[model samples]
Target: MRIIHLLVIGALVFAAAYVYRIKMDSTARTERVLRLHAEIREQRDAIAVLRSEWAKLDAPLRLQGLAERHLPLKPLNATQYDSLKNLPERPPSLVRPGDPDPIGAMIQTIDASADASSVTGSVPTSAPASEGQQ
Candidate 1:
């Protein structure tokens, strides 16, 4: 009877230890989550500050002032503009009149071969024969 009692007490102690360990682990995880959230918030604040500074630095007036100080530029003048009629005439064609088009000759050769093949019944034709031919 005493041995049974001791065994029950041992099981109870072990269960308590397990429950304590689980609770400690939960608390540690909660603290880690809080630390991560804080770090994320800090990063967001830093990004916002950087964006604000970028907006100030990228102002158009500031950039225009910098350009005026560093670059050698002048304003436009009306005399600089010219009409289309003042442009020179286009040059003459480089190809001679007697030169035959190679692409057109190739297309004609293909058409002739196709017609010959259709007449010889070596190749099938997509178009039906006319009633007068039949």
Candidate 2:
């Protein structure tokens, strides 16, 4: 009888320990699930903030100003665009001696060089490099 009672008591203690371990495992799992839920909520809030900022940046007026500043873009005028075909062709300016018309001189020089090059295929058009200190 003593031997049977000792065996029964030992079995009961072992069963109680198993039940306690199971309860602790379940509690740990619940805590982990709650932590994940909290993390998901935080991510959603961060995404909302980012979306709001994006919307502000994408506003039409702000985007237009940014384009004007960074890119060579202009607002179209309907009347000016419609009359584009009537625009006058630019004529060559009268060249006078010793006049510092840099743009006109450059245009004349390029045209003359091109005509000479086409006429005489063997013309040494390139200027020789001068010796200079770097």
Candidate 3:
């Protein structure tokens, strides 16, 4: 009976030690979590301050003032505007009169082939002229 009592006491002491260790670990983890949360809040506040400063720097009035002081640009005037009719006519094509347009020929061939394929109830699987010729 005395041996049984000693064994029981030993088991109880070990259990108490284990429980105390677990409680200490839980407390340390909780402190770390709180520290990390504080760091995150500080970073968020810094970011908000930076964003506000950026907004102030990027205001349109500030940009206009900076541009007027540093750049050689002038504001628009009523006399600067022109009527569309006053624009000159387009220049002639650069291609010679006798030269054939490869693009136009390819487009026509593709259109004709597509029409023929539709009439025959079959799709044309051939590659485009530009790719085939290459």
Best by TM-score: 1
What lDDT would candidate 2 get against the real structure?
0.77
Cα RMSD (angstroms) for every candidate in the order listed: 13.9, 17.3, 10.1
Q: Model 1, which residues run further than 4 Å from truth?
A: 82-134
C-alpha lDDT values of all predictions: 0.81, 0.77, 0.84
Error of 1 at 128 (Å): 25
Task: List candidate 2 segments past 4 Å from native.
Answer: 75-134
Across residues 31-127, which tens digit of lDDT does each residue of candidate 1 receive? 9999999999999999999999999999999999999999998999999999999998998866566765666567446756764545655434544
Name the candidate, 1 or 3, with the larger lDDT value.
3
| Models ranked on lDDT | 3, 1, 2
State residue 52's C-alpha deviation in candidate 3, in Å: 0.9
List clashing residue pairs in candidate 3: none
Ranked candidates, highest TM-score first: 1, 3, 2
Which parts of model 3 are misplaced by more than 4 Å? 76-134
Candidate closest to the true structure, highest lDDT: 3
lDDT of 3 by residue, 1-134 (tens): 99999999999999999999999999999999999999999999999999999999999999999999999998789999899999999999876777767677876576676655464434344645445434
List clashing residue pairs in candidate 2.
none
